[model samples]
Target: MNKHIVIVGGGYVGMYTALRLQRKLGKELRNRSVRITVIDPNSYMTYQPFLPEAAAGNLSPRHVVAPLRRVLPKATILNGMVTKVDHANKKVTFVPGEGEPREIPYDLIVMAAGSISRTLPIPGLTDIGIGFKTVGEAIALRNRVLHQLDVAESTDDVEVRRRALTFVVVGAGFAGVEALAELEDMAKDSTRYYRNIKPSDVRWVLVEATNRVLPEVGPEMGKWTLEQLRERGIEVKLDTRLESATGGHVVLSDGTEFDAETLVWTAGVKPSPVVTEGDLPLDERGRIKTTTQLTVAGTKDAFAAGDLAGVPDVTNPGQYCAPNAQHAVRQAKVLGDNIVRTLHGQQLVEYRHKYVGSVAGLGLHQGVANVYGVKLRGLAAWFMHRTYHLSRVPTLNRKVRVVADWTLALFFKRETVSLGEMEHPRDEFRAAVASNRR
Candidate 1:
């Protein structure tokens, strides 16, 4: 049988699962007996854990993403979105980067569409609130932060300076804390070049609706992390909600008000809404329901394992595995093996791995980690954070480039210039045209 398998995403699961299958089914693939096609909006798999470094100029944005075509040489890669999956018909409506949507048939499917940033309806948020989910957002925030500094330096108005220097980040999860910390580090380092702007002038604030940050590391570590943040002159507002941000004017649940030119929303994430567009069974959380063995519940030739799939945690009874990269990476291994097992008429292996704890970097040479009940803080944890992720980032090319970035950082200060034109390359050209016409 010329088996065609279409993977609905090229993220952590979709990419890794395809990689594993390519290894296990080499003969079958070479014989033209098995085929794999991976679809995604971008032609790459972004290693999100490195996004903070990318934003802070510690690593290049391109280094954090693995081009799908380069990594999956044996598989078909489509740059597009899967609008709908009619599993009953064994087909999915595929929309390319451009052009009309068309239905593609497949004998098997892997749902790994992943999650998206979960944002609330806060005023002025649509205009001012920036997200911290993608590499592009990271680059944009970096540029905007640096550009704000230039505006502050050029103007003598205290109010304008205050607005430009004040930065607010919502959500105290790993993303929020890391992003605020890394950007603050970059901004403070950038002050040496500005004769007027000092590191003391910049205000970094973190708001969390929940009472704690880094909950994945447990309460004690969470408390320690909070303490570390506060010690760095970073404001940590717990149990505080963002009431509004109209016109860059932030109003918090605790009645705190400020004009922050930069407001980053890293609040949380929900499973990709595309999950609802498919016929797969989903749990109450709107994630595809799958067995511990990584197969979709009550379905054959259909599989899912990622942030969008509700995989059971056999290690912890009555609980589903958390939506995280740690679990997603490991699940992909089992997911690929199970698919191969199914094709070979072998028994499917169940996925059951205990939680390995968590890690987060707080700027340079600072971090916190809780691994196997061993709590580490300061530089030790920072090293662990880098070591763990370096091993996790796909491909030797990316790993080498990341290491090169870190090596160069040791010998030189970060490049602090803001290329604001990256956001609008044609603005200057348009202005030139208007001038010529006049």
Candidate 2:
């Protein structure tokens, strides 16, 4: 019997796991012994860590994502969402981009659906706030910041100018910090082209409910990061929460209120809500429960990893592995091999590895890193940050393209052009039709 495997989600875990299986089960896959399928809403696997650089125009957004068809030619790529997963029936209801939903049967299932931006019920947040998790959001933010500068420069209204120049980012985690730092730096540099704006006029505020930034990098580095941002004139408001952002009126829990044209929400992420339909055992956090071996606990022919999987940490008892790209990429290797081993009746190997620490870019020519018990800061950390992520960008094609982008940066200025119309390509056509009628 041919063993068919369906992998859901085409992000880090899904792409890498299928790549491993493509390499390990090449013979089985070719001879009809095994089949692989990957399903995702987007056709590409985004390297999320570089999103800040992409947004800052330091790296092209295209280089940070690997197209699913180009990366995994051997596997069946489904460009759509998985609407339902009935493990008992060995089928999942797949919905394509422009078609009705249909069921797909498989001998085994791998849930790598990943996560979504965790949001709050804060007033007007949904209307004004944007999350920084996708390539689209990153580029949109770049354009949005630059457009705000344009608005501020061309306006005479004090309130309009103030709101346009003020940018607020909530959350001080790696995502929020890097985003704030990179965008702030980019916007400051962008002031050279504007006649009325100075770098000082642009107010960048970072609000975090926690007391420090980059908690993953340790308290000392976090403290240092705070000092550095303050030195750059970035308002790092710790122990403060965003109470409301109605109509771009940002109201902080500390009894402060301000109007800002841009609000980026990067507080945290929760598992993709699609997992709720899978009928699998989920932890309190709504992640699929999995063993260290990467198999869904107490279930056969089922597996999970990445942000959506609750895999227990062997090194730290009573704790689950952190849902970061570090663990997701590593766990993918074990998952692919274990699936192959199960088919061959071999003993499954455990997925165990101590975390290697973290590195974060604080914008151009600046960064902080904690790796293997060693701390690095400033330009050295920045270089390490680029080198580390450059190595992990996936595929030689993408790596070379990313390196080329960095190399080009050394000789040329960063592109600050804003193409906001990309979001609404039909707006001009609608206006043309209205003019024709007039």
Best by TM-score: 2
lDDT for each residue of candidate 2 in 1-438, tens digit (9 for 90 to 100) = 589999999999999999999999999989988999999999999999999999999999899999999999999999999988899889999999998999999999999999999998899997678999999999999999999999999999999999999999999999999999999999999999999999999999999998999999988888999999999999999999999999999999899899998999999999998789877888888899899899998888999999999999999999999989999999999999999898898999988979999999999999999999889899999999999998898999999999999999999999988889999999999999999999
Enumerate clash totals for all models, in the order shown: 0, 0
- Show the lowest summed lDDT stretch of 10 residues, model 2: 273-282
Name model 1 segments beyond 4 Å from true: none
Write candidate 1's Cα lDDT for 331-408 as tens digits.
999999999998888999999888888999999999999999999999999999999999999999999999999999
lDDT for 108 in candidate 2 is 95
| Residue 378 accuracy (lDDT) in model 2 | 97
User: Which pairs clash (backbone N, Cα, C closer than 3 Å) in model 1?
Assistant: none
lDDT of 2: 0.94
Q: CA lDDT of each candidate? A: 0.93, 0.94
Error of 2 at 167 (Å): 0.6
Query: In candidate 1, what residue range of length 10 has the lowest lDDT sum?
Result: 119-128
**TM agreement with the true structure for every prediction:** 0.98, 0.99
